[model samples]
Target: MPSTPHRWITTPLTAGLVRGALDLEPTAQGILPHRLPAWARDQNTDGQLAMAESQPSGVRLVFRTRATAVELDTLPTKRIYVGAPPRPQGHYDLIVDGRPAGRAIATGGNTVTIDLGTGALEHGTGPVATLRFAGLSDEDKTVEIWLPHNETTELVALRTDAPVRPADASGRRTWLHHGSSISHGSDAASPTTTWPALAAARGGVELVNLGLAGSALLDPFVARTIRDTPADLISVKIGINLVNADLMRLRAFAPAVHGFLDTIREGHPTAPLLVVSPILCPIHEDTPGPTAFDFSRLGDGRLLFTAAGDPADGAEGRLTLNVIRDELERVVARRAANDPNLHHLDGRDLYGEADHRELPLPDRLHPDAATHRRMGERFAAHAFASEGGPFAEAEG
Candidate 1:
């Protein structure tokens, strides 16, 4: 007889078992709802703890398996709950092993059942869904089980033989990064191309991405979220979003940063936390941002900025990368005496003087895929490497 197949069993446990199982927080603010296992809670606008409202709409479960042969089995009676407030009409893609396995449609109601194969699973809302797996080899693979627009639905329970634990059981190290849309991977060709993802790959460390597009306003909840998690390495890319949104003034920026770091220290007493400012953005490099424009096209196929000469052009202390960089250094320097683990990385160092000449960030805001690759390489060399280097000692 052939050898008996080896299998492990996974069942739902108290939320407590899931807590601290990973270094990252499962909750996210803004358009995306907080996604926690059945046992976790969501934070309110006032930063108070509340029952989690719904599931997340994007990638959630991600893990790598060492086993060459894998099998997934779930309870046959599982029922997907489509809660009240029907979601937008869209089809959901079921992806397994990073490839499409099948699709679930949400035409009217919210709930849909899917049959994902033995591989990983990913689901997304869509009209045209395609599941393709053409080049998968028989070996250990990283699995990403995704649910797009899942905030409108809930994954009541998941049963599988694949281990629920992280790939790095040894707990060698951790890297936590907080940034804007770029870090959140707005326009990357693929999920792994994001700078944070790329850097994590090169550094040989686990990554926790706290990137929120138009949402990294130095919120206390975010600081608390970072504080609550444990990490071996930490970095925060600030400025660009603040400038773009005109969220704060000079008077409010410094103290907010101090408080954010203070809160993080409360959780990670000695973990290295590097504060990074924005890279060169020609529009806001020297000029105050919060710039607005009205796109009006002439009879010809040409566009013009109607609000180019608006009165709000140069309000006092408006957002600017140069201004933020100066202030960020001052803030880090002031806190360094008491917090030895704190450091700063000027964003320009990652993509500055020389890079702009060759590969400018498309749209003057978010870096293109090439920029992400370049930035990831430089970040690994200077910060993530374990050997004695710029940030190695502080990281520990």
Candidate 2:
């Protein structure tokens, strides 16, 4: 808990003060940040996506202030694991002048518990919590207060020692990326530390992250969201969610992929578009899914994921990482011939068997903090390096 300041000035949270989110919804508490607009959200029935898109993976509050002390009142929704070790409270990271600065965690709010075996959920409500940061340089500087990547939060109020205003744009190209939990900051240390956020930092670009956890299926609405959003660079990391969720079989996947890309091209025909496949996940390398929680270690307060589909089922057109990767390669190769701005990068180039053996995923499904950093560094080098990168400034 931070000490309360004497003469606090309140600043309303507005869309202009936010960066990375597509829409802002007014809430009884204050405002809720949304990665997808209301219209797009209304089209989906999957509860996972509804939860994921509202988690605000790449969303942050960007403003200019000379306040040495700042306080934010928020109502964050946290997860409670029954019969398992507690999940850490989500983090609030502060970035100043493009540098890592302060970090805080909200104390209390709403909570939800999903039963491991039954898949049942229970909710608990709590009071709003205040996150505060004090004793900073008083001179004007841009401040980015990054919300948690794994928790949904409502902005109740913002107070500062000095008056605050929206920050100006960075004058960098905007990068729009969509993918699964890996891209959505699962197990990552914080919001800005997610692979996409880390890569965006290295690329010196504003970020529009659509990396919804466990919800990046080849949905038309997501494609439309990407199509309508303004972006200078675009990338889609596919395959993991499709495999783990077992949403569509091979017969439907190809056309779904084609249609998804076609929708994106309609709005961004000339934008440098990169199609990335899944990284190495040996568990799903050959096995199809429906990934299941590996309960063998739950007794030890550890949670791991395992593929639950049969191997012989491949003949039935079941989707696996290998099959998805191959099809994605073919799709990109064929499309690139006609669409010069379109490109493909094998996700293995970002994280392959060799790297996995060195730094395995902590939960067998998502990368840990260190792995996120490694992936971010590798992705940045491949996608943003001065020369030989498909996303180079002169790509289009």
Candidate 3:
């Protein structure tokens, strides 16, 4: 009897098969899920959760099974579309059955092509024959490919081996993160260097980055996106964007957050989701957010606020960090009795009083790389540490 080809090896963009034929299931678009490539797992590397960086080594694919004999087949000419950042520069490694197969490098946009060898059956009687790749650095990275498994085999598991320590699959765990431009990492450094990435590294769980720069509008879509993704933990950092963008009124803010969490419950059911409010922003701490500035002028003194109304004025719909924090606590308290998994973390807890006093955000918006590192460490200790309250059981 011949060994069976249990699973198909393809990029996330391409459809996967659960049993037999190609299953075209519609995944939630706009919202990005942290996915690991097959090759990442083969190499025993814990790939980044949400975003990936381009590396000189490409990703690989590995197959695990109980069959005695196995065969190897390569697609003639296939395109691997990568959801990478603009002007990506790196190489990709391709591996098969723990052997180096080939390499692919980023060209114009974010697509790489690899010509697999002849589609012939190779004899293999091992429990697992992993296809792996190397060559991704800490930059923006995303790739998709098409590798169809033989219809005769059984598909067991799929994963990516990233640089971080592999997470335990035993108990359920969830990680939630929130932030401003720095959290979103507008331009400071590479993709993997973002606070969310660092934090996820420390936590050892999947992440849903809700750090929308110039856009964390508390929009239904943002909340809906969070509500939709499955998770064991959750957090939301709100403030900077609201203040800088000057998008909401105080009256609407509290209810909006409630609605956001409420929506998330629809999908997550009973997962531990932490609600993180904004940190201390002096400019917006006492003043109402939604402040405006002219993009046309800056150094010339042409910059000016469009409105004189104070966000502190309770009469108006203006917002402030302090006010948002209070409301968040109230919202959680109101809903806590009904939902045991619901929790809240003050952003200040990660980078509060002392840290802010020492290092303020550059340009009054984003944190520097050091701050990102600190934030990651603090988050891990508070949210994911086993000895801690919320994530204690999860850590086990």
TM-scores for all predictions: 0.65, 0.97, 0.57
Candidate that scores best on lDDT: 2
> Mind giving the per-residue lDDT tens digits that candidate 1 earns over 204-276?
6666666665556787777777777667778898988787667788888899988988888888888878898
Question: How much is the lDDT of residue 260 in candidate 3?
Answer: 74
Give, for candidate 1, the lowest lDDT window spanning 10 residues.
72-81
Alpha-carbon shift of residue 298 in model 2 (angstroms)? 1.3
RMSD, one per candidate, in order: 9.9, 1.5, 14.0
The C-alpha local distance difference test score for the whole of candidate 2 amounts to 0.91
Which model is ahead, 1 or 2, in terms of TM-score? 2
Better candidate by lDDT, 1 or 3: 1
| lDDT for each residue of candidate 2 in 281-388, tens digit (9 for 90 to 100) | 989999999998887887787888899999999889999999999999998888888999888889999899898999998789888898899899999999887897
Q: Candidate 2 — number of clashing residue pairs?
A: 0
For residues 306-350, could you state the per-residue lDDT of candidate 3 as single tens digits?
332475474576767777788888888889999988778888887
Give per-residue lDDT, candidate 3, residue 210: 47
Error of 2 at 266 (Å): 1.2
**Candidates ranked, most accurate by TM-score first:** 2, 1, 3
